[model samples]
Target: MKNNLTKLVKKANAGDKQSLELVILEINDLIYNLSLKMLLFPEDAKDATQEILIKVITHLSTFHYQSQFTTWVYRIATNYLITYKGKKSKEFAMPFKEYAVLIDSGQSDTVSYAKNAGELALLEEEVKVSCTQGLLLCLNSSDRLVYILAEILEFSSKEGAAILTITPDNFRKKLSRSRQKIRNFLTNKCGLVNSENPCRCHKKIDFLTHQKVINPNNLRFAQFTKRSIDLVDQIGDLEKAIAIYRATPAIPAPETIMKTIKETILIT
Candidate 1:
């Protein structure tokens, strides 16, 4: 499956727009899902997917096959996100009214809270929707970019190093610091156990994934945080934390994208 997918990707990279679109469509759900995980808004996820499609089309020929095509695309999306790091507060929220219908075709059937019989009445189920939101709140644009690339994208230490344009050793150090920052925020402010309790950290990662979370046993989060949650609480007020996201003081969207394509992508 991975190899055939790679063949399709290579074709797409060679300028097969239809194949490219198929590849994009093939991964669209996870792309949307990942965007939502990082951007934390439904509309933003949709918008990001749309923009990412344009980028993938424009930049396809540049795909060097150095990494798996998905990883390469992930790098592009993350970098575009970093460069476009606008305020997060304005991102479109998912609508509760149409929540069930907005389901992505590739969504994971993961559950977070266990169920057997009547369970909600007595079971002390933990909800960390806001904790995920709050963690994004604490991280700066660069920090969030690195953290998302590492955790949500499931990039290996070496892979993340390549994407971030840093050495693997350096990437590990930065990752450690990012983890520490999250732990500190939780412990100092909310008084949660930093590293002693493994489940809490796991729950935090799961919330960030933003997938179907009804069944407790099915929720599979990024496992990097399984051992620790000692993030440093250096984060301050929410006002400063948010750092208003702006869309690069926009001009017309299509024209800009076209210009970017012409300038960045070299075609035969």
Candidate 2:
């Protein structure tokens, strides 16, 4: 797949319009998913994904095949996300202490917006994904990026370091610190990580819905997910706290993103 992407990139760099479109098609989901995880909002993710795609396309000639095409793409994507100061980034720029207080403050009132079991299940899933993604925001952008690459995306330390232009040992240290921070919070506050914890996804659904933090009519995370992360075979051995992120469904890029990219390319 990397080889094929490299070939497409080469063709696109040589002015093959079809290959350029194909290149966008191949990496759209990847860029969108990473952006969504980093930004924690679909609209913000969409906006950031478009910008990053434009960067990749505009800088196509700079890729000299010294690294894997995907790695190069990741380097570009990660750098953009780390420095991105989007609306949600500012809103969610909080320490773990503040976030933990927010989590603990939720009411346990039972409010059912769902008419049936399936709808109720979806709402619960929405809370789980939203809550976990929110936890990620507690980490600063740099640590958040490290945790996302090392845990959610499962990149090796060396690979992550290379993408971030850091040494492997430095990458590992950041990942360890970030991982422990999240684990500590989840272990104390999240029921999924510890059965003794008071916070449950189902219990928070009512509070979150009433607070307008999550809408059953328009779920941001659960609506796009086809399968839970636990259903995937590769995550069985991962620690539960770390695995919670993997549970986020692989959200695809917006359907019109390709058309928009093509038009933008033509204009530029």
Candidate 3:
């Protein structure tokens, strides 16, 4: 994918309009998904995605074939996110309502969580997904970006450094610090990380439902295949820690989001 995208970028840079459009269309989901993960809001993610693509197009000539196209593309994205601040997630809350119906309808039965539960309970399960994503907001934008690149997105330290335009050593240091921060936060506040914690997902369901923040019938994040956070060898039982963070899903932007990106690209 990266190689092909690099080719498209080269074509687009040479002034091929079709390749330009194709480049934006093909990477729309990737940009939007990253934006959503960083901004934690659909509208913001949409706007940011459009803005980033425009920036990418405007700066297409700046890309020297030195790095992979993805690295180049994500550098633009991570840089924008590093300096860009949108909504304040002073508390970890997600707009589950925006995603619920779409996700629930498209959920695969092969996915375990979607199968054995009633609608409402399943929706509560999805809250865990949003909750995990929300945790990214706790870190400053740069740290969050690093964590997203290195941990959630599974970028190697070298690849992450290339994307962030930092030295590999600097990238490793930042990644280590970011990892520590998240692990500490989860260890202290999340029941999943330490089973003895009082903060259970089930316990929050009633409060969340009564607060009108979630609707079980229209579940979202819970339906996708869950992914664990990158295990830091610095901490607890590596296996258990892995299992805890693994429960969080690596969510993709929905088709609607992809369509919205396409429309935004056309309009711009």
lDDT of 1 at 16: 76
The segments of candidate 3 whose C-alpha lies over 4 angstroms from its true place after superposition are 88-116, 215-220, 223-250, 254-268
> How well does candidate 1 match the true structure in TM-score terms?
0.55
lDDT of 2 by residue, 26-73 (tens): 999999989888888888898899999999998999999999988999
Candidate 1, 1-268: lDDT as tens digits = 6687788888877767566556765656655555655665444556776677677777777877777777777777777776553344334333322222322122223434425422321121212332344345345556666666675455778988887677888888877777667544444433233334333323332343354332344322212122112222222332211211110011122233334433443232
Tens-place lDDT per residue, model 3, 1-268, is: 7778888888888878778878887767788778878877665777788788878878889989987777778989988977776654434433334323222232222332334456534655655656556666767787778888877677898888888888989988888887887776667666666677566565556555554455566655556633232232333655443345444555565566445544665445
lDDT values, one for every candidate: 0.49, 0.85, 0.66
TM-score of each: 0.55, 0.95, 0.75
Which 10 residues in a row give candidate 2 its minimum summed lDDT? Answer: 225-234
Question: Largest lDDT belongs to which candidate?
Answer: 2
Q: C-alpha displacement of 32 in model 2, angstroms?
A: 0.7
Model 2 compared with the native: what TM-score? 0.95
Clashes of each: 14, 0, 2
